[model samples]
Structure formats: C-alpha cells, structure tokens
Target: MPNSSPKFSYIDYNAQTVTIKRLRQLSRLLDTVITVPGTPIAIGLDPIIGFIPIGGDVLGLILSSYIVYEASRLGVPKKLLSRMIFNIIIDSLLGSFPIIGDLFDFAWTANHYNIKLLEKHLNGY
Candidate 1:
C-alpha cells in the first residue's frame, strides 16, 4: 500500500527559504533601513533613486517584479498573485512621476507589502 500523506520536499523548502531571505533583504534595502538625521522618519534607497530622471522608477519596477516571480515559483494562488502585481503596478505608476512620484515612492513601499502578502500565503493563511 502507498502512503497517502503528502511528502514534503526538503530541497524545495530550502530553496523557498533562501528566496524569502533574499527578498526580505531587498525589501528592506528599498523600503525602510535608514533614519533621517534630525527626524524619526526612516527611508530607503527606492525613494532616493526615484530622483533619477527616467531609469529610477523603471529600476524599481524591475526589482519589484522579482518578488512576484518568486511568489509564482512558490505556488502562490492567483488571487494573491494578482494583489501582489497590483501593488507593484501602483508603485511603479505612481513612482513614475517627477517630484510627486518620489514622494509616493517614499510612502508606497510595495515590496514590503508584497513580502507581507507572501508571508501570509506561505503560512497557510
């Protein structure tokens, strides 16, 4: 008789863990890792890079896409994937503008949000 229980793949789990760790590092680098000198506010490279002419926002979009790709690999459901893509789209679209977009990037933090979503999904929630 064959076992009916699902067999967990240790290799897959290890791969997923590595991916999550890298994504978390990327999110922190882009979203919130620095403190303003005279204020309590924290910021990251994403908004600062948004000050670049045209390439900055594009770069952000590309970076954000990696998370979505990883999520897909991890077998995230369609609904959650849609939400993750939406977050990236909103961040990219808003971050494409000039001054306003820079401000938006500062506040949006889409990668952080997507990471949270990924965590929720992975946790079987």
Candidate 2:
C-alpha cells in the first residue's frame, strides 16, 4: 500500500535557492542576452568560465550536463539525447583549448541548445 501522506516531497522551485541561480547561470537560457553596451557578443561566460586554470572549463561543461540529465529523466528520446550529448562534447572539447577555448565558451552556448531541445520535445512538434 502507498503511504497516506506521500512518497515524495515538494520543493518551492522559485522560492530563492541559490542553486537555482547558479543553475540558471550555468544554463544561460534567459532572453535579452544582456551584454555590455559596446561589448562584442563573441566573448562571454561560455569561455570565461573555462578560464579557471585546468578544470574550470571542464567543470562548467559537467555542470551543463545536468540539464541534459534532467531532460533524460523526463523521457526525452535517445536520438535527441545523443544530439544533446554531442553538443556538450563539442562545447567541452573546443572549450578545453587554451585561450581560444574560453573565448569559444563565451561565444557558443551548449545549454541554450539543451533548453531548446527540451522545449521542442515538450511541444511535441
């Protein structure tokens, strides 16, 4: 028999968890694509986050994978999931380069693609 109350607990997703904020930053799914008034769009956090010496960019890539994992848990198809994984791979591999990699991270956004993949899957088109 099932528990009377519940087997699962609820979390207030919008109720101010810093993890949420970090996740958002790691994901970079927001609109507006805010930037310095005159700054070029080619350089941003994608590569900036990778500038953390040795493991910084890799760590950022790892964190980005969480979103894809979530999508998998949500039953996204394996073919599409492969594409998502490929995006992360290309981002991580290219992002592992020295100076250029960090710049690439800034320019390219794997998370944005993952988010889009989810949105498309959700809409079922």
Candidate 3:
C-alpha cells in the first residue's frame, strides 16, 4: 500500500528557528505591545484584560502557560522551566488583585522574561 501520511509531520516544527520567531512575536504581543504615553512604561493585553475580574486572570494564565509549554517542547532544562513556571505563578497569583494586581502586571512581563530565559539557554548562557 502507498503511504498515506501527509507531507508535513509534527517533527517538522523546527523549534530552534520557527518556534523562536513565533514565540518572540507572541511575547511582544503579550507583554509590550502598548507604550504608555509620556512614559517609558509599556504593557500589553495580559494586564489590560486582567482587569476583567476572575476571567481576566484565567486568560492571562492560559496564555502565559503557553510560553512555558513551548519552552518544554524546545527542550528547556527542568531548572529553567521551573523558574519560568515560578514567574507565571507569581504573575497569576499576585496579579489577581484589583488595583495592585494591575500595577503588578504592568511591571511583571512574565512572557518576555520567559522568552529571555529560553534565549539564554539556547545561547548557552
């Protein structure tokens, strides 16, 4: 019988190249897409939507978790992965507050931080 599999397989993801590019774009979108007027501070949808009570934090958690999930797929070390998780957990927990949580989100760019960790590992740092 002739092979019936598709041309592209799951192994074709090319995590080192394509995945990194996509993750970088996602990190930027989640953590720094918007710049505060007349200030150096910038933020993205993570905090903006975080103002939506329970659902907002849940959404942020899911999105932040995606970065960690991709990092694991990229073969990031367990130690580093744990650190990334810690960042996400902290972001989710403390960021669940009302006023302070939003403020925390403004300063805590967990996705960006996680991406940096991934790069450091890839760069052998």
Candidate 4:
C-alpha cells in the first residue's frame, strides 16, 4: 500500500513558507535535539520554557500544535495524524496540571514521538 503517514510539507505562516524539516528544515535555533555540530545556544526550548508557570506551559502547548496541524494540512493519513493528535492532546491535558504537568512535559517529547511515528510509517521500519 501507499504511504499513509504524514509528510513534512510547506507551511505558509505569516506569508512565509515554512518547511517542516525533521532536523534542520523545521529545526529552530533552540530546538531540543542539538548535536555535536549543533550550537549549544540553540538547545531545545523544552527545558527553558518548562520553567514557566501554568501560563508558560500553556504557551508551549499552543506552539507545539502548529506542527501537528501542519501535518494534517499536508494530507497525511488520518490514522497517523490521529495518533499524533492523541499524543498532543494527552500532553496538553497532562501538562496542564501543576508540578506534575511540568514533569509530564519534560518526559513526554510529543513532537519527537510524533516525528518518530511519521518516520516509522514512512520508512516501514
């Protein structure tokens, strides 16, 4: 069967096209997945923002949704998108609590997890 997982296509946010590249294209300066060649200054935002109170965590959750929405728009398969959406929902719901929420966010790498799911389905790994 044809691939049903989502693809990292282009996102027209604010009149600019944003390509969701796994490591670099979608990668930002402070992405969590920094490597040897990656700049230390650009570490992932997971740690930094998790320090914020409820408001900060809420903001993070909102920001994270953009990727999933973009994936849906790219005509990714419903099944894959559903799984990604499920992760996001759970992350947000669990992340809304007090101290435990922060802990959940730290442990739940929803973006990474969703990306892995996409890669797995795409590569048949």
TM-score of each: 0.86, 0.70, 0.86, 0.61
Candidate 4 overall lDDT versus native: 0.62
- Expressed as tens digits, the lDDT of each residue in 34-123 for candidate 3 is 998998888999999999989999999999999899888877879999999999999999999999999999999999999999999988
Model 1 clashing-pair count: 0
Per-residue alpha-carbon lDDT of candidate 2 for residues 20-80, written as tens digits (9 for 90 to 100): 4454565763212456577555334556657788777767667778877766655668998
- The Cα error of candidate 2 at residue 65, in Å, is 0.7
Model 3 scores worst on lDDT over the 10 consecutive residues at 6-15
Instruction: Show model 3 residue runs off by greater than 4 Å.
Output: 1-14
Decide which is better by TM-score, 2 or 3: 3
C-alpha RMSD of candidate 2: 5.3
lDDT of 1 by residue, 1-125 (tens): 86675543333778889999999999999898898899978788888888888898888888889999888878888899999999999998988888988888888989999999999889888
Reference-based lDDT, residue 68, model 3: 92
Candidate 2: residue 115 Cα off by (Å)? 0.7
Regions of candidate 1 where Cα sits further than 4 Å from its true position: 1-11, 37-40
Candidate 4's residue-wise lDDT over 54-120, tens digit each? 6766666666667677666655688889898898788778877778876776567777777666656
Clashing pairs in 2: 44-106, 46-105, 46-106, 47-102, 47-105, 47-106
